[model samples]
Target chain A: MAMLFSDPFESLFNLQKALDAFHASGWLEPGPSAGGTYPPLNVFRKDDDAVVIIELPGVKKTDVDIQAKGSTIRISGTRTIEFPQKAGIHRRERIAGRFDRAITIPFEVNVEEVKAEYRDGILALFLPRAEQDKPRSIKLP
Target chain B: MVAPQELAVQPKKELTPKEEKTVPARYYVPNTDIHETDEALTLVMEMPGVEKKNIDVKLENDVLRIEGRIDFSKYEGLDPVYAEYNVGHFSRTFALSNKIDQDRIQADLQDGILTLTLPKAKQALPRQIPIN
Candidate 1:
């Protein structure tokens, strides 16, 4: 099946970057409130199936919890990073702690058939459209 | 005990390579944290979706370079519908001091995070002096 949907937010980021380049300083920098959502996601759809990918470095599978209901999916987890007691922090930029995010799709999700895979700190969920939500063709006499 | 709160994912920053590259590919610098102890200096980098075999660590002229390649074949037949971040190879470099013993440096990769330990030279370490 050919891929039908593409990330709608991709254009927004491109536009923001272009504006930033023009002004050298982003007057519209959404700051930490907007655009900076935890556990960044990428969604791809092929026919009636959609795959959601999340990047979570140094996270354990046991820490994350995923749930799907109707047209929404929720992911919640904690990220912990530990160092020796005597170690001194030189420069810290990476983030840690807990994160919870919810995403809603256009069609009802087949929660029972959804498949999840975690590898190399990346979690991907394969969601199929619900059977009842699929379009049906009617025959005329 | 305090409860943990939600974290914001920082926007990915792009790093432009200074020198001309043989391959015209975009490279994003991975997020890193540096920690130092009496014995060694540790560097932790976030490089998701990259296998251990695809990473390269190099040292030349007291400069340490790190690079990780991502396999694009994973997205061959897929079309993106929503993307919050761009996928690309990771690249970054650090200038090391003589106090670091490059020969004793160690590297480890786990769960898409790369850790590098650079041990201090024996002579550079502080020593306890006895009373005369």
Candidate 2:
């Protein structure tokens, strides 16, 4: 899951998105706070489970740690980006940071059955709905 | 097929002579086609090699900015054996008009495509009137 950006226009686009990220997290930065890299996340709710995904390019499976509670989940990871040694670097855009994101879910969830998987820089989390949290189908008498 | 122990990730390589320049060149400035209707304005952006996580859409200083980053480097102590596409981040800004309702803008990213739906300001939206 290696991620390196070499485009010239990337800075301009990141500036726009960073503004929105600041509004959501109350801080413009994510990571270890010491050169932390904050990747974006997408959250959605299904009928039986809640799915949360975080983009973590170049991060290895062993590099991430996740914790889940009744209605919240925490993800922590790191991306150490390296560059070519003999390339004679003129511009650098790779980010190195520790990332910790804590999300409070909208509904009660089953924490014991939560699972996470990472592939090709995408982390997928599946948290099943708690027994009482799931909607029931009833037949009228 | 490669085994688990011998998994060989792509290696980082030195840039070609073309890549050794000051600022990378782009074929064109990524732009959006904005079409306004009675209710919403549809914006389609030209963004390739961008993912949902790398993309950002926001309004600041009366400008609509679109941002994205791409990660494609493979490994250390190795050099790329082949190459095709170049990876880079993208940024583009558009001037927001009085006709737009900034607060209600909705964006969706799918398969590297970013579609933003911005509903018009009520006063700026078109209305129908009947002449009796």
Candidate 3:
């Protein structure tokens, strides 16, 4: 029985590796052509809701656009920097440009009830799971 | 132009001292942007999850040190489902040259961004001389 499952598991691992490689190439759709890279983000599940936290320093709230559909959420924003003319820049490590990121939740989400908040350069999103996607305890007669 | 330090590890001495404190297992070197104007040098650093009260900026022995402590306790019992960023403290140091006006250095923290302004010394400021 172990041998029977090994082949499929190996194939699944290979598929995951391929997906990782694709993402690392920085060619994901709606790419960073605007000079911005993907912002760091975190996803946590609590009870029946999925919470997503994103770091977007130097980006104003007005510049951010978020859209959610079914189980996918898309976030896009722009970061701009302005320096005085004739001023010499000694060092620059922060990236300033437009960025787009799309994340797929593991479970279906209730689109209408999703809530979002931006504070302290961080964006937090609360997505409630769909009725059918949430786990329920069944009553046994 | 000096390249801004990106995710550079702290020297051993700096790391050893912090280990005795809150004892964070890791440190994330925050991305920073440094700009020099005729008046001063400005540095902007990105450090999310670090509140204004938790940031420490010190200048001593001609070195400017910045450390931001992350409050991981905020997530106390929440299980992490996915994470693309690590939860840890942020630290970096810059050696100040004699041209910097150490006494006038100013720092501000807002919305997770730290801005530091290091003014230039009077002697270092450029001035136009009248032609004789």
Candidate 4:
């Protein structure tokens, strides 16, 4: 996917990134307009935390904007792709578009203390557990 | 078999390529999720926009190959304003560690996710010894 977005032509990268944003959220019904095959993935979960990893490589931390409120977390942002005028391009695919994905964490999350990290092309999020919601150690008999 | 469209679609300006890693030249991004259960491995792969008529799975030479394609050209003439997810042709291969039985592999694709049940081969299953 990174290969497709390497166009130096500003327009190509700009538009493709826009489309990719839309794709990350997913699209349906095609006719010059299509949805992305890349979905904001939901990873495995443990008792107290539910981890969500989104594959948005070639995107920078500044380009991404995220919000966590109550039990829902919303992500919205853009990954800039450069398109140089001198560079010649034969084909393009990657993606670029405004994408927003909000997940409803099964249990109430600390909302205030969620941790997020972006490395390479993957976004990893750690949703902390509320005090009362987390399991307490039971005394042995 | 490789297709022309597949080649043309993968843009040329590739990454600086940290390592010379190579995935299939032509393959679909199979939506996948792998979770380990107490007894087995559950693999859920999404292959939406693909019909059953054009999908198949084969494990040979210690490689698991899944091949399928979307017949979107049928819907061509339409203007393309945006194309973020363009999956025209697809193929993916995984090298097995020689522990799974090729014959016992079970698969099903429903609601867009292709699930393959790879039970532990006879010699790989765990056994609990009972003490008298």
Off by over 4 Å in 3: A1-37, B1-22
Q: Candidate 1, after superposition: displacement of residue A56 in Å?
A: 0.9
TM-score of 3: 0.75
lDDT of 3 by residue, A51-109 (tens): 88777777788989999998778888777766768777877877666777777676789
* Candidate 4 structure quality by residue, lDDT tens digits, B1-132: 322121111221222322343432233456344444333444555554455677788877767777665444322222222233433344556665536666777787543446666665677656778999
Docking class of 3: incorrect
Provide TM-scores for the models.
Answer: 0.83, 0.40, 0.75, 0.39
DockQ of 2: 0.02
Question: Docking quality tier of candidate 1?
Answer: acceptable
Which ten residues in a row are the worst by lDDT in model 2 chain B?
A: B74-83
For TM-score, the strongest prediction is 1
The best-first sequence of candidates by DockQ reads 1, 3, 4, 2
Off by over 4 Å in 4: A1-141, B1-26
TM-score-better candidate, 3 vs 4: 3
RMSD of candidate 1 to the true fold?
A: 6.7
Write the number of the candidate with greater lDDT, choosing between 2 and 3: 3
DockQ comparisons of all candidates to the true complex: 0.49, 0.02, 0.21, 0.02
Model 2 spans with C-alpha error above 4 angstroms: A1-37, B1-132
